[model samples]
Target: MHKSYVGRRRKNPARIEMQEGNETPTRDQIESVVSLYNGGELDAAHAATTELIEKFPAASILHNIRGAVNARKGNHEGAAKDFQNAIDTNPAFPDAYNNLGVALKKLGRQQEAIENYRRAVSIKPDYAEAYFNMANALRDLGRQEDAVSNYKQTLRIAPKHNGARNNLGVLLNKLQRYEEAVSQFSAVLLANPNFADAYNNLGLALKNIGREEEALASFAKATEVKPDYAEAHYNKGSYLFDLGRRQEAEASYAEALRLKPDFAEAFRSLGAVKRYEKDDPQIPYIKSLLDRNDISDNDRMHLNYALGKVSEDLGQHREAFTHYQNANFLRKKFLNYTPDLERRLFRMVRESFEDVERIKNIYRAPAEPFRKTPIFVVGMPRSGTSLTEHILASHSQIYGAGELTTFGMAVNSVWSGGEVTAEQLQTIREKYLADMNRRDVAEPFITDKMHLNYRWIGFICMALPGAKIVHIKRRSIASCWSIFKYYFSDFGNGYAYDLDDLGEYYASYMDLMKFWEERFPGAIYNFSYESLTENQEEETRKLLDYLGLDLEQSCIDFHETKRAVATISSMQVRRKLYKGSSEEWRKYENFLKPLIARLGED
Candidate 1:
């Protein structure tokens, strides 16, 4: 990851097209609909689009208009269907492809969504707007380098494209090119003064470079311009939290949550406040919210995840498992797919990691540019990477960016575009390094706890000579069984139907780790999960010192920090370090005994 304000673009810049033909049977009707849409009469536009389609069923233009209207009205599924209808009606229509991609992305069909976006640009090379949409989709698909190039492409074609420029600024920030990101954000402000998000993000880039006072001013202007902006408020609150401005930070965090209640992060932040008994009014906020069924589905899903924490903390494993399972269910429900998609995704991730050396080809040249590297905490999902991150993040110098996919994204960008050569690999590696520089943490360190990064560690080190790998180790049974019960929402295998896959996957991961350690001695830091649980302080101190940094008292008390953690262990990590987690597998020992035998654990 580059830095706090990097890797993402300015919010939702691309707009769907609404066409009106001067010569047609429904020419007057089309003009009237266009007038209504231009005047923000979305309902009237929708009706007209429907009527026009009824009268002229072959018109892609009418379908596109309907899709735009549906999109504006927050009917993304409807908008996506209409856009797809437009595409089906006119297969070569680039605008429809772009709009369909945006709608599909909003609807959480990311892979297909990105493919549509890519097709849009391919069909219309000079369509800067299509490139902008493509860039956004690429960023979401975790293909940051391509997004960077596309953002640049939009700006190259249209320099005054404030949106693309702003997005480039964000990507630069992720690339760890703070000065460049700042300049880009400043450039957006120059072009359009009321871009509140740009100012807020500018402040992030500024704060990253240690420009505290200037960062504060930018954040304040962002909030002043858009008081309801949750991110701006959150940014200011984070700054205040750092400065120990407890009351001010609490108010800001509260305001942020007030505006975006479905934000799992704000709730997690509030939970952290409660954990520390920070000078903030902390109720059973998340729990109390869950008691009400009137809340939105998004809120319910997050509540279930948070509830798992409370249950776990209260020694309610059964309740914890149920809520986590529900959370896992709900997060996946956002993706509208048949049963086949899961199998496809499994193959996709598996196949990518199959050839270790081929995967190595994804890393850009870092021999000269990227000397200092981050601590890569790689292990199974529940194998204590979060805990390791939290422990290490407790250090005064190393701020936890939290489970980022910067390295994987950069690597994936290489193969994701399909199998490549020596030249393509080198080009992508440089492009991604440039992207990484935008995220910040270009120098000494950053924690990219993308646990899956474990599979790519060998390839990563080969690409970037100075790269450091921390192999977070956990007992085989403990890791596998923990994953089986809690369930994961994002990737496949968390809901794997068979025990054989889980066991084999576990064995494969361990074997991979062993091979890497043997091949590249001193490249991996093997920290046993059980050992760390027994001696967090000593081990954490050792880990920090190994990175050549002095440990702060604060690092030892990482639980006291009030930051938003997005992992399954967010709730657990907020509380003081405890030993019970080490005993977690015991509860399900009877259930996992056969699985243990599969691991050949006699």
Candidate 2:
């Protein structure tokens, strides 16, 4: 088992030799002060260190000891000054440098701490603790790659460093290297089976890779190891909800709330699992929390959204809209979004792809054969992309890999410099296929319903001419209003936060889709959401025929298809087709005038 290393102040007994100056404190006096500090006698230690520092005015050891005492007393600034003084007194003392880094990190001077940590490691090449500390500071600065490298170096020096190993797993998970993350987390479990966090992290990695059963087992293991682990319970609930086990998911979420009464995320998840009636007790509880000044901004945002959902369920449309608006306002204040900037981006996209002849002239076919035929479903958010995917996934040979960002990421990678070559396009295709394979896709035709793929249609056609594109169209007002009603957690869709921005974005989306239609004629199959909802059988048949598949009864009975859905429409897609959602925008038409005006519906 890997041993845990608790950081503590250490005094070098061999460094207690007397100096030549008569005014210098005796080695015995310094040793007594160090013992007082290490023994948790902070007040007595501080007094003794101050008196000794006067006698031994040039002793770096005294300053470092005083800094440790100050840090214990929660005086970070004072501790930092004392540590800096120690370093100035003895420039070659590696311990003083490392201690100064610790003090600076506590003061939130991460960049300065990193520099001191670097100095400490340079002075003592085998300083694993210094390397670990430096890695944490780098992570705080969002230099994840550098942090990963430093963590690896720490493990090399101290192979039993479980903390470094666990942190490395977290970084790998953030980088989307799920397989490597699983391995790192598994190593931590092998060393200590009782590590609940490792189990939780392993579950997330497993879930990302489509190992649903294994992921559930990991989450269950985490909860078993720590019964009161609120986060683990919440994660388990999320997975269960995605898997369509609503009752079990509700239990998990409720348990999380019982353990941590103020757990906002768990409350939100519970609200989503089951709709609340007009007099539901949870609604009032959430409202009371909103009245408190002690709750964090993030919690307040969640509570407001929860209240909005409940109000909407109770048919209080005006109250619901107000709550949704307030919630989005709070969230948007922290996001970096500019409607004009997004407008310029849309213009750039149209300009880049509007010239069909220019695009064809520059396009080159890859030498490798594009074997897989990806059916990409792209459109504005809340435009029935999930419903379309659910219907098509009912076909035996059509796998629904929901909302893939791989193609968008690949396009960004290839086009970051200049024109993409045929070989580069082939590499992008291979990368996309590799990602699909990672998701356990094995069917001949698969649906990639990443709605934002609308922006990359030209690139999609250029890279894979054999791919089929399905553009789901909804009424602009309905789409924009639906976007406004929900809180999109992804900052990439920040335009949804405001009515005017939502309207402008919808307009830009239509313009780009028009450009794609003109640029790649006959390549896209435009499907209307309202038309499909009104004519399910006819539309389902048309969609299956487009994919070259036989008319299967399951396609029309798509509501019965069991699969993991991770979108807001997860519940909606599981129900039979209905027409009520088509005209929902009419209820809040007055509040939606700004969006209507921007979408040119006025």
Candidate 3:
């Protein structure tokens, strides 16, 4: 009889655990109620528990069981009340407090939930479940470091706690600690080989660190383990899209949407891959989704941007402008931007590098050992940086390390009181190069087309004297119009959202470039976008000669280059040069009066 009871207790862990140190209810009674609740018979369990509580009104365990049933039924308010009743009846009951926290968390009362969890752990110091619950609440509250600590504590107490381990991995990924995140996810997979979500998360961590092949293998493994995983397919599509495999990306996104019909993000990504030439059928289907009242704000933003792209492709200039305007307006609501903040930064940069004497004095310091000369393509956004990069990357000796932020980040890290030392310069240079090498760049002349590096020209000259700076210039109207029409993911491009802000920012950029040119004469090579388009051969030869490289016909035939381009101009760069992009802005000249007024062109 004793052996049979122990076997039954093994199958009903929750009931046996709850009955410990409690005498009101026999083990059989507790098992009966808990079994009904655990088996998905919520209504029947609730009725039985209500009768049990009436018979044993002061039974704290029965109240906790009823609260668990209420929570499962999504009656969080009722659950909180029942859990509080249990706690009040037996103030030392740790399970009652823990269950109450779960109910409060479901109600979005995270602070209250955290307090209850603390009470649970205080009553029972080794309560691994309460620690895990508290960690989740902390993560939701954006206290990531505290969440990480609590999750670690949870795992220490309960070594096989899979939930804590997986969540810790996710929080680490958000914090950009990809290596640690990979380890956590790997441990999860080792414990349970069929854990599909862990495999997907491990792939994301691997991708963040530039291990593309390994990441893809992990994503493939997830799909193999869970054949119907829509999110894994969507992630695969996103990775392919980033690598410029548009056809494969389209197929992956389509499969994701087929598996989950209401997947709005997959639909938006599919539209991006379509490239929306004249009269694409997907345009109308995307527009039809806007009529659905349940569409999310993010989905609406993507749809508006897609509509703008399709309209632009079809040569509906006015309609395209309207959609672009709506999209920017919607996105701007979520960003913290002010024109004055940018203007002030520009002012500070100019003043910092104002004196040529001070710059020369810094140059007089000992120079670092000369390394390979890197070509920096610096200019305003949409000023033909991508085109110039594509042209230069066609050279066998040059590798295009697209739009590196390493120099900019290094400058931000070391800038102090307008003074820099030779040692500091060398440190910055070595750090920047180390970052580039990690990206697998080994060419003698790599092009860092980080357009905003225009602001860091003085630092670049001091740190890397061998580096060649190419300044790409575009006409003001065309540049501003292009910026306004596009959606930039970088928060630093906040000025692009508004016409007046864009104009002012462009003026600041021009002013700073003039300062750099004056301070470092003959250091910058100027290239005009219009000139490049009009005289591809003449300009390409001049650019090649400037870089001291013999002319390669491949530079002129850049369209045939197979390298991946991860820019807004990715599509344009894949085709031969067209002449109309410069003139297209004139069609919307009337609506761009604010921009024209700000540029002092009127």
TM-score list, all predictions: 0.64, 0.85, 0.72
lDDT of candidate model 1 versus the reference: 0.70
Off by over 4 Å in 3: 1-218, 275-281, 359-366, 370-372, 416-427, 437-441, 600-602
The number of the candidate with the highest TM-score is 2
Question: lDDT tens string, model 3, 424-503?
Answer: 67777877877655554566788899899998888888777768999999888888998998877656788888787788
| Clash count, candidate 3 | 0
- Candidate 1 vs candidate 2: the TM-score winner is 2
- The C-alpha stretches of model 1 lying farther than 4 A from their native spots are 1-131, 137-144, 157-160, 168-180, 203-220, 234-252, 259-265, 275-296, 332-377, 380-410, 413-451, 460-468, 476-505, 518-525, 529-581, 584-602
Q: Which candidate, 2 or 3, would have the higher TM-score against the true structure? A: 2
Q: For candidate 1, lDDT tens digit of each residue in 1-602?
A: 01133323434322545454443335676677777877889898898778778877778877887888888788999999998888887788888888888888888887788788778878888888778877877887768778898888998888888878888888777765678899999999998898887898898788766677898899989888887878787777766655445577677778888888756555644443333332323336676787787887666766776666566566666776677667656655654424454345344545544554664555445447453356778888888888788777766666676666566666655664334355645654575466555564533566777788876664566665665677788777777767755534454444332456677667767776776676567878788887777887788778776787877788778888765455557556766777767567776565567788988875
lDDT of each: 0.70, 0.80, 0.80
